[model samples]
Target chain A: MSGLTLIASYPKSGNTWLRAFLASHLRDGRPIDLNADLSEVPNLTSRSLQDCHAGLEHSDLSRQEVALLRPLTSRRIAREQPGFYKTHDSNLVPPGAREPAIPPDAIDRVVCIVRDPRDVAVSAAAHFGWSLDDSVDRMADTAFCIGHSPRRLNANVEQWISSWSAHVESWLDAGGVQLLMLRYEDLLADPLESFTQLCRFLDLDDTRHAVSRSLEESRFSALAGQEARGGFRERSRTSTAPFFRAGKAGEWRTALPAVLAERVVGTHSRVMARVGYG
Target chain B: MTDGLLCGWRIRSDIALPELLDWQGDDRIPDLVVRLGEVDERLPEGREISPLLQIDGTGAGLLQVPMVGRFLVRPSGGITIAPQPEASEAEIRLFLLGSVLGMVCHQRALLPLHASSVAIDGGAVAFCGPSGMGKSTLALRFAQHGHSVVSDDICVIETCEPPRVRPCFPRLKLWRDTMEDAALSPEGLERNRRGQEKFHFRAPHAGVREPLPLRAIFLLRRAGSGEGEGIQRLAAPLDIMAALEAETFRLQVGHALGRAETLFQARALIANDVPVYRLTRRADAQPDRWLDAIAATIRG
Candidate 1:
């Protein structure tokens, strides 16, 4: 039976982009509408978990403020087909830690998006309103691999890489989850090839040529045009801005200063080389 | 202390009412006073009283009911005079005494969830859902169907003794709309003028005292019109957690640590002891079908 495919990634790691691409590619060559957003999708988060059992035990959370995703995480594998979803809680401990992570059987495939640590830092800074220095500092501290500083903490890139490494290690240790590693740069380099590989993993039958055409059809310019003119509102939730950011790799090299870049390289030099970024 | 009309109790404690501007009571003061008549009927001279807060009173003429516990005495002839005994502390202490906390503190008991519980012939059926998901409405219907009223709103479970949930109530409450929609008997209906969403129906003495072993837990949902089966049950912990969390109340209770542990234990009891199902019904559907299905499951 086809199980749920989780478009898993650290926040802002292009999970949305992948989802949009797949959704648009799957439909009969029709562009996926962004009108409904992630929530309108079926079997989204269960709102009940927040109220009945979770509330009294967790009264600090208001009924309206609780999220629908926390409760639905366990129901992922139970569906006839795997459900695709996303999350941002980095502290989601290993299954044995405090609360159990997502159940094992529910997940058929786990696709984690790994970007160059420096680029992740830059994207995080712009998207989350975090300064480059603090992002790097906090990131490094969280991964427990390298150092971070506020003023010119150069370890941004290294820490970014280390965070991904830890995430990968944790998922691998968990076992039973089919892991597919994707580099953001590779997708940017050849959208068609990347789309073809992802479709194959998801067990879809669309040809590479068709996927390439679809990718070209759904390019940053095309996607942004739909976003700017509200044409994509049928599929996307956020009306304020396009989900597609700068599709270029190494934008962080120029956006993030030399000091931060040096720190990234210092912390993630080995992983960078492993991913051929050295 | 006897006030001739209603008994007056005073609790002398160090705890002070911070909201009151000038509390000159060096001795004891009345915190909870359950008066029998309307506020207009009785009043002692030089006494201060405020209409009940938070509660839209259905049984009494007062606008609000005292929370937890407070002093109860009749107001005398617009008197607003005389020093009344203060027992806010004693009331809270008594509340916590008869309360689930009282049972737990005394016997390490668990608190039953704050939802509606209905007692059928052999066992009780609990309607567990968020506040506005029609829990009380369904429970009230079950009671009207000659099922014993285990609880109108909140049911307390005492796991230590006989493993039973005691239904506590001064009265059974129903919403105005529910009463109209269900076509329930209006014999004992007391219209609550304070709020549109509340009313009081005195629970029959027979239903109040009878205890039913809880047999089934149902999570209610509106029917979805589609190609798929509108409703199907699945044994998913996530669904249970999701349903329960929608109604979870004390995430962090009173700065205490083990409060969460107690809550988890209560959650586990419902999860382990009873069968839970997601019951979907159309707008015009009667709730008895779902109740009967649960009852059949319990019988099996």
Candidate 2:
């Protein structure tokens, strides 16, 4: 609760869902406004936050410089602006950087949400307008990163997400921070139990009614309906479907081709099985 | 050593600053002097303003960019830079004129907005925003139409009645796609940093020597799909003040120098006297669609 309490996850891995529950829970079960209220657990990598702390524009720096600079700013954010923040950064060291962007000393705790790689591929594809094959390949790519600006400035600082398997393993192996791992499928199965665990981990009000009320407020249907009415600012610019498209698990059986699903499972088999994911 | 004009100040520097205009003002002891010297890793009595910035009790500031260099800025208008052996001039000049310039403005009690402004209707129409919000890109669009660019990254405000903007050089830093969209080639232009696609495209026209009256301020933001996109004037004083505060360059340095009241008054002046607006552009839509609308809005 002192340093940065990060809700860290890979993209399309129910990161927003956890943040939404926390947002409502923090307000004592207030009905959450999807767009406006999410700032309670704001994105840690947002460009403005990085720029203000870094004292220089990330757009002007090369990738290596940004990688080096992030850890410094991370410590600043920890010391000055300590609170809940969401990120999709892998815990591994980025390319050309000595340490992870968010070093251990800068973190109070980590609530890492990981989803089944197969479902993540389907969700990521729809969210990014990538084909399922491309999504699978990108998630398997060791050098995969997000928010990198090649030809223009990106909205957020670059995050070295690496491969999904590497991403999963990195946080699992992260030291010196209290970590709580949650499976996206488990959250979907029993929202009350999963979210209660989340609240307890973060030392919030963990009573059943409070947890259930927050879970009910931030349920998948409500979030989808809200996005349908007013667009999600966090939605990818290239997103083909709605930001909350098909929150169900096991949809890869239908949406994803067999080969693509196989590729995800093959590359991420060890981490997947270790996390009790299919 | 090179002599140049930046933010209406005669600058004599050992570093080459090609973006600045050749000094035309009568030499009366250069207002700012830049030289090569040793810079310490950290200030002993200085308080940390940010990860890379520090400000001492004397209101002097130190800025160190890891691979570039360190800029030691004093209240007496002296700057000392110790560059890395491998640092390029482009990278060195970037911080010298950018972050160092903002620090100087704070030291001089001037307001520097993190904006890119161009002359519209013979006055400065400033576009303020955080990085990647298209402030420079919009200025580039205006510059392409032959509008005189007042400033690229930091817009210095002369705390006068109308809050005139001191004209910096018309060196706009643009990304590769932006230049391509504007039909300008990036082949010969120098990159903002090595291995970056962003190029420094200098406007062919010489910069206006005199400060232009501050006509309007537009805070640029990107709207997501299904969200409203247009220019809406901020009428509330708090909203305008908040927007201006958000866009103030190196605002923390100002506060650290015990200039919070001065900055607050500066923000109050903009909020009270000038018309500030929120201009929203769709993230996926054609960005140039707003050029004409912005011109019309500014003209009105």
Candidate 3:
């Protein structure tokens, strides 16, 4: 049992695919269908506030008083047993509201999947049921810089493009943690190879055959089926919403209205160029 | 390049960094590294480097904390400002810096605690809980009433021999929703650059109080319909040990038996020697009642 490995991604990034691949590998090439038994390791993100409170009461004496000063504080806890934890939030300095949710210092390794912002905007729009223009607009608000100031800094697509770069930068800066960046398109192109590399970085033996059984083209179909049946969404312990949405990369091409697509390309041209997407 | 002074405890890394990078490259190396105080324009490259909490000094310990992410020059020429990372802006960077620093330091002198600490009548009181448990809100409420806040969200717990837990650092962090709920004005809170999500409070030290003889440890929760009822005092040292460790342990500091762990265990042993109470408060009700109960316990 080592520390928890976090598969972190911006929402709608290829986090689910990575998680599925790893899960499949860990399960030894078994088809981790919708009926997979995830009772052993629960989703911290989906865990209900009520469940956490109730669960605390039944804790053994060691858990009752174990001080969690660091977000990765559960390294010891995981050393006793390794579990997979996934999160969308970035690591914080003073342990912001989200970081404290898990034991600080508990994350032994982090796998980040970065996609072109254009693709991300398109993916985000479809998931949130927003129009392409609306998604691009939202991404441009530069994280909604509507703080107390009247002058809203109009950060166009450049800011959105830099968002992922900034995120990966922070993770790398924080030493003792290994970060693996995977492009969404690259993952979509070759699921098995992508997952195998991910496993190697995570230090998990690739013998699990997670990709072999899942197949390539069927991966998306299976994921789509899972999403249709609300498999990934169901796995979420929290009642927030379904997680699996459209997993396509170039969805913005047709899905994004022509005008909005131009605005996205226009604004994030630098960023798009960086990821070789523009 | 300005002279860099080594702080209280200096850790030098063998890994050399490019002459310039955003923030300090390593938390284990030293707290602050300064090239140019306010005039420095070098920003950390790559997405991983955060703008908050840079290492600046004559060399190492002799340093300045940036004010509102800007260097504030003191009239007396002592430019030591405590820069609280904008919660909404650099949440991840700040969090990671604190986590890494807290880890490499080995919880020896600086222990990270998943609790909120506030200076109260001649001592400090810490409320420990997990996320969504309202630790920041509780601490902010007390701070508003003139109780000096030592740390919010995460408190660096420093312990001396004989086992006294002292909170180092002055700041409180709140979610956007919590700030709204607590009615705290966001005029002063800093916004993060990347995500318009969270905010950080720059706490001003107003009241003078001693490192409280660990007052009382309360594991908080939003009381439900039926749960542990009433205010019951936990008498067993073992029970106290269990509860305190769960709430206060910094696992990132590594080692199953670090000095900080030993000190914390020792403090809990003494705390178990003291009074431990469970205050079941209405989730809908204010935290005042629990505060009053803690005061009474401390007094008695």
Residues A1-278 of candidate 1 have per-residue lDDT tens digits of 35556666555567667766766666634565543333322222223332222222111111111222233334432453345654333323422133223545666676767678788777666654668896666445544321122111111111122365455445445567787778788888877777788878877756966686557655677666655555332222222323455767989868899999888788667766776777
lDDT for B1 (candidate 3): 29
After the best TM-score superposition of candidate 3, give how far the Cα of residue B239 lies from its true spot, in angstroms: 8.7
lDDT of 3 by residue, B128-179 (tens): 7765566777787777676777656555444554333454445565556666
CA deviation > 4 Å runs, candidate 3:
A1-11, A27-119, A126-131, A137-241, A262-278, B1-114, B117-125, B129-133, B142-177, B186-215, B219-265, B268-271, B274-300
Stretches off by above 4 angstroms in model 1 are: A37-81, A89-96, A143-162, A172-174, A230-243, B1-300
* Candidate with best DockQ: 2
Query: Tens digits of per-residue lDDT for model 2 on B193-217?
Result: 9988999999876688888999999
Provide all candidates' interface root-mean-square deviations: 19.6, 1.9, 15.2
Question: Per-residue lDDT of A77-143 in model 2, one digit per residue for the tens?
Answer: 9998999999999999997888999999999999999898999999999999998889999999999
Highest TM-score model number: 2
What's the TM-score of every candidate structure? 0.43, 0.94, 0.45
Q: Judged by DockQ relative to the true structure, which candidate is superior, 1 or 3?
A: 3
Steric clashes per prediction: 84, 0, 55
